[model samples]
Target: MLRLGSPRRRINIGLIGMTFVLSIFAGRLIQMQGLDTKVYETAAANQRTQIEEIPAQRGSITDVNGHELAVTVEAREVAIDPSKVPAAVRQKIAAILGRQLGKSEQEMAAKLAKDRTRYQLLARDVDPVVATRLLQAGVPALSTKKTYRRLYPAGDLAGSLIGFVGDEGNGLGGMEQAKNTLLAGRDGKQRVETGRDGQQIPMTSSQRTEPVNGQDVRLTIDRDIQWAAQRSIAEQVRKSGAESGTVIVMDVQTAQVVAMANAPELNLNDWRRAPAASYVNKAAADVFEPGSTNKVITAAAALEAKAVTPDTVYQVPDNIRCADQVLRDAHAHKVESMTFRQAMAQSSNVATVMAAREIGSQRLHTMLKAFGFGSAPGGGVPGAEAGLLPDYKKWSGSQNCTVAYGQGVSVTALQMASVYQTIANGGVKIEPQIVAGTTDTSGRYVPAAAGKRTKVVSETTAKEIATMLESAVGVEGTGQLAAIPGYRVAGKTGTANRYDAELGRYEGYTASFVGFAPADQPRLVVLSVLQKPKNGHFGGQLAAPVFKDVMTFAIKSRKIPPTGSAAPQVRMRAGQ
Candidate 1:
């Protein structure tokens, strides 16, 4: 607006403008390269670096003989970078992956349309072979991450005992849940520079932390013995049309559970389809009134207290009144005088109750507690219930007499088994064990610490009770069906009225048999229990045969020979 300048004047103005522009450039360069150099460098590195998780392998669960129960197999997880996928080939890539991943083409297309998303999961736990094949197809933007999936090779053989895993690779129940920390290893991490093709740059500096694989868990259960026990119980449950059943076999010397099986079991591989009730390890968790099978406790109590000798005699009645209640025997019979051995062999509730009265409530309670009642069995079994045994102070006169013959008190199957195991082990009540040990990274097994031992009765008292138990399984007793050929089997049959909470009264019956073989020198104790049998409710009729079948198998499996002599005969009637 001023006026046209001369050529020299115009040149001076242009030089000043150029100097101002150069000044701005110099200032900006200094601010970026000198002041915020680290900021720029970090930004560049972030674009070229990627951090990834390195998963560690979970441990395996094996049986006593090293048979695999639960194991982890190599697998892969497929993912997609939707934004990186080329638009022209999105449909084709989606179609190819959809077929292999069991997804619909429409679903895949919809996922790929999320262009703003950097990554999307296509499939998890894909078979490694299938993942490899998919990768070879050259599907754009498709990627794979290594992973593992748990598999149970034994199906549901010991399903409830072995337990299953959750989607995130955590143990959910049974031995798996109990030993999760030892079985789940630590995860690792890696950070490295990536090239434009999303591949790690060779010879580049990187950081990595190695993972620790989990140790193996070895159980004391023998697979073959477990199978035998399972088959026997299942067959009996089906034949008797019982609601359900449980069987437990334990080694007398170690008190280690050789077989713990429950009927209505689910295939562990398909645990998702199992009913909620089937998930419970009944042998360890469920409790019931042990019925006359608990008479052994009374017998042992009386003998140990010196209240009565094996030859002590009592005038038994079909029904006896005790504190506003009349307790009756399983069958009505005329009053008869009988020896302690005869009362036990015939399973006379009246005689047993009379003997218990002699022992007194407090002494009887002490014996029960010493035999591992009213407490958890401490077998390292998760969810093992401490069976219900009311405090002696709360015991009414009726309750005291009822408890003498295995009523009013509750016990888990494992606890009942331990009661017999105590006698079989010569009065030393060893804490039961399920998990034998755990393996190291190098597959060397470190045996578990020994179990605690408590003396429940004198060795002599135990032998005396064992002799009476032997007579109970002889030719003239209620538990005769529990006898094995050529073996002096010792056991008791229990038929207890099942308590129904809704009805607020005892309804139905729980048939059970608990015993050990070769009474002279026991090796194994087997307990079989059936709930609510439709065919027959008596323990001798419904449960004893199952015990015999399972006990025979256990005896043969362990290669235990028979006792050379027959069980000593006992008086079956009064004044014999």
Candidate 2:
């Protein structure tokens, strides 16, 4: 700057200055990538690499015999890349999308015409063939994402019990909803390094936390028995023109619910088309008047209080008054002398009411509570209800008499089935268990033991009740239709009209039969309930036949032997 220079020297000075500026820029890059390496390296890695979660697959649902009930399979969701399509081909694309995705052709065309943006999910669950056609047709907009869809191999067989999944592949109903946490998978993720071009570099400081898949759930349900029960109940519902129906079968000893099914079932594969009512598991959720079924509980209370016995004679009248309530038999009867057992065998409401009176209301109420009425079965199934049981202190006098005969009290089918199971299991009231096992994330199996035992009635008392029940299958018994020839049958028939809230006075009826076969040593306890049958209102007529078919299959299928000698004969009907 102090010396004057020739023109060539000045030009060379300018050129040297420009070269020095370029060198400074290159040195700054070195500082960032080398000298100040940590700072820029952290910035670059943060900008280029991102941690993402990878979801593990959920476990399968199987039956007691390891038959797959519900399983998840990988599927795909397809979207359209509208921005890549030409305006000239928009209508063709729209028609193609309409045929594939079930979208309105005109609406899709309009949307394509107005938008150049990439379209996502213009279609989903596309058939592979359709996708191939799209590719062949050179439809520019289509993309796909791998996803999962739940498939029920058994379909409507155990849909209500196993439940169905939502569109998002999450559990929505039944066991699916109840054990979602144990049955659902969790995605895990970690940091990973990437190249400057946004490409992942294998084995380069990747932080990976593996995902844990959900546990496989095994239930006590028998697929064969479940299907049989569902078919039998559905056929009966259709034939009898009943509003609905439920059938339940439980192992007498294990309290394992072998089969529980309801009519009007929904196909799990197409659950969206099923009615909401079909989605409910009537066996666990619906509560109804026990009708004559309550009489058994009344008898239990009487026996417990030493108020009566099978031989104890009671002056059974056509009607009896306890407080202001007049108890009348469903059938006409005189003030004839009848033994307690005969009364039970005949299903006499007056006799049970008198016995309940002797036991007193408070004691009867307590026994009912202990028998698991007024409470949920704690079966661990979802949508289980604790049924209605009015406290004795709050009961009207009529409530006592009506409750004695199963009129005022409410109970679910599962609850009612368990009560009989307790009697069948010699007074041990075991909790009903459905799930058998569940596989953990590590592939280890966890056993389910919800059938914990607790004693309610004495064995001697249980045997007496069992004997009294057997008499119902006798010729004089109202439930003679329930008798399976060659095999002893012990069961009670219940017929109660549904009290209409709009127009009182017992509008419709629910007929039900709860019984055990080979009465000497009960193997299975089957309960079948029919709601509002158009053919007949009697349980023996409407539900007993279904029960017989179910029990017969159960007996033959289970290979249970006849109780006694002389080859007990099953009476052949006149049909064939």
- Tens digits of per-residue lDDT, candidate 1, 327-406, equal 99989999888889888888999999999989789988988898988999996987899999999999987998999999
lDDT, residue 30, candidate 2: 91
Top candidate when judged by lDDT against the true structure: 1
lDDT of each: 0.90, 0.81
What's the residue-level lDDT of 283 in candidate 2? 92
Per-candidate TM-scores read 0.93, 0.87
Q: Which residue runs does candidate 2 get wrong by more than 4 Å? A: 1-53, 98-116, 126-137, 188-208, 499-506, 565-576
* Candidate 2 residue-wise lDDT, 186-235, digit = tens: 86676777764334788777778987778899998888888888899999
Please give the TM-score that candidate 2 achieves against the real structure: 0.87
| Model 2 residue 489 CA deviation in Å | 0.9
Model 1: lDDT to the true structure: 0.90
